[model samples]
Target: MTKPLPLALFGHPSMARRAWPLALIVALHIGFFLLLRDGLLNRIVPELPSTIVTAIIFPPAEPPARPVAASPAPKPPGPAVRTIIKPRPAVRRTPPVVMPPDAAPVSAAPAPSPIAELPPAAAPAPAVPPQPAARPVHRATVTSGVQYVRPPRPDYPAQSKRIGEEGRVVLRVLVNEKGEAERVEIQTSSGHARLDEAAREAVQHAQFRPHMEDGEPVTVFAIVPITFRLDQ
Candidate 1:
């Protein structure tokens, strides 16, 4: 006896129903696609008109020709030429003949006098008396005496306590005829304010001998230097 197939293994009837609708739809779609493809091909391709079919006629090829001649070969170079020359020595020429001396000299005419020797120079006019030379004027040079301090001060700030510092300062002072200081300039700094100030003060107070030029007083510039050392 043949074994009957199990109901569970057999496909459902609903699947069969779905398969029929899908098959129908696919068939219809295929027919529609074929019609659309045919219509597109007909629209895009143009119909060719009737024309005479002529054989492709290539122009007759020209007969092979002979190559043109290359320009005539350049003429062979001319033979190298040789020239012959003879050398001759140079000859020097002598100058023409000249007349001998012994010829008489020619005399020139004398010139007439203009004023008979210029009137003897007029006796040079009486010699003028010589004037005395003016006295020489001399410019005065004022000189300043050297300052001598009884006690020497230290050169360092810590050593000179009284002046608060110690250093050397050079001052240029203009002394007038009256022996007074007209202007004072610090020529060199002492590196210490106190020391420089002291030097200036001393110079102002110092007396000067008026410079005399031609026995007259004149103003002049003088340079004064002051030193501050320890032990003052």
Candidate 2:
């Protein structure tokens, strides 16, 4: 071994010893940085050459579309067929025959002569007849049961206050030989009890002439339509 060097710096032994270790660490770090830089550049730079960057281009577009062809017009229908109709044969007519004229002349026959006149004789006198006088005649008279007939009374409620305010009431009645109403029935309603009742009362008290048949008083069945109407 070489003679041991003096480990003193400016008379400081601790400073000299610290300086060597620090220098050795700084040298190792510098060497590692240079080696990393060289390796990274060598790998990446070779693949990335100096190439020109250009945008992609597309194919040219087709021209604008043309109009579609139209269908052909339909042909006209064929001409209509002609029909010839034959006429019927005419009827045959015969001409009338003419007769020849007569050659001889025609003559008329003569009339007979008149007779001679004679003298007149005397006539007798005519008898006169008397005319009879005309007799007096009597004519028969016809009468109707309706001439003296009266209407029947109406059967309605007595408590009803409204009188002729309602409509008319019609009643059908039959008359007997005694000139009295044999039967009475309402033919129609007056739409009010009072008016109907009043009509019935009147019909009950009504008088009538007896109906006659074959020159004698007889009971007659007749339809008497009595109307109960308001005065107004």
Candidate 3:
């Protein structure tokens, strides 16, 4: 049980002291090296290279077009719509009437006239008398019973005398109230127009005594005959 004595590792106290310095230096160097290794692992970690695949994208091809259907025919135009305009009624405007200030008023019944109603009516005029109608004059034929103031003397036509036309012509002569021959007509033809015309002309220029009825002269028809003789 005595106090223990110190053991010498380096075989000397001085050697041990010097060995402690060397150990400290080695510890410091190991610590610095471990720190550098940790820093290099954090800064430079290897990453795998990514594959560079360049994909080319082309648009898909368009589908084929379908055929178009035919269009329908256009509809026909409808009848036109007409807009009728009615005329407005006319207005009649009459002007107001104005009467004159100085016009005289008319009475319903007029006053009676005393002068027209005072006198009596005149007596009716006397009735007139009627006269009788006159009678119609009588007529007769006097072939040879009448007297002649100037007898008819016919001159034979030169052409008839040359042709030897001979015939007798009877004439109906009208004798007037003045005892003169008014009209002459051929009662019987002479077989020749020239002979008959000559006899009619001669009788027209002659005068006759008028027929008598109760001693008064009257109008009558007288027949006269003329002869054209080729020997005379």
Per-residue error (Å), model 1, residue 6: 99
Q: Where does candidate 2 stray beyond 4 Å?
A: 1-145, 149-164
TM-score of 3: 0.47
The local lDDT score (0 to 100) that residue 27 gets in candidate 1 is 77
Q: In model 2, how large is the Cα lDDT of residue 214?
A: 63
Instruction: Please give the lDDT score for candidate 2.
Output: 0.62
Clashes of each: 4, 6, 0
TM-score winner between 1 and 3, please give it.
3
* Model 3 lowest lDDT segment of ten: 1-10
TM-score of each predicted structure versus truth: 0.32, 0.30, 0.47
Full-model lDDT for every candidate: 0.68, 0.62, 0.84
Give the per-residue lDDT of model 2 (tens digit) for 1-232.
Answer: 2233366543577776777677677777887788777796576557656789999999899999999899898999999998988898897888875545764544666666666656566566576676676633322222234655554445444354343264676666566668787666677877766676677677767777776666867665545444544343
Best-first order by lDDT: 3, 1, 2
lDDT of 1 by residue, 1-232 (tens): 3243344544876665656667677778887799777897566677788899889989999999999989988899999888867777777778875656876655787887676555555566788899999856544333455332232232334445754665678888877767777777888998877678777777876667776666877667777777876655
Candidate 1 residues lying further than 4 Å off, grouped into runs, are: 1-164
> What local lDDT score does residue 15 receive in model 3, on the 0 to 100 scale?
75
In Å, residue 121's CA in model 3 sits off its true spot by: 4.0
Summarize candidate 3's per-residue lDDT along 1-232 as a digit string, tens digits: 2232344656877777777778678777887788677886456665667999999999998998998898999999999999999998888888976668887765579767677556777899998887677758777788677798888889999999998899999888888998888889899998999999999999988888778889999899998989999887
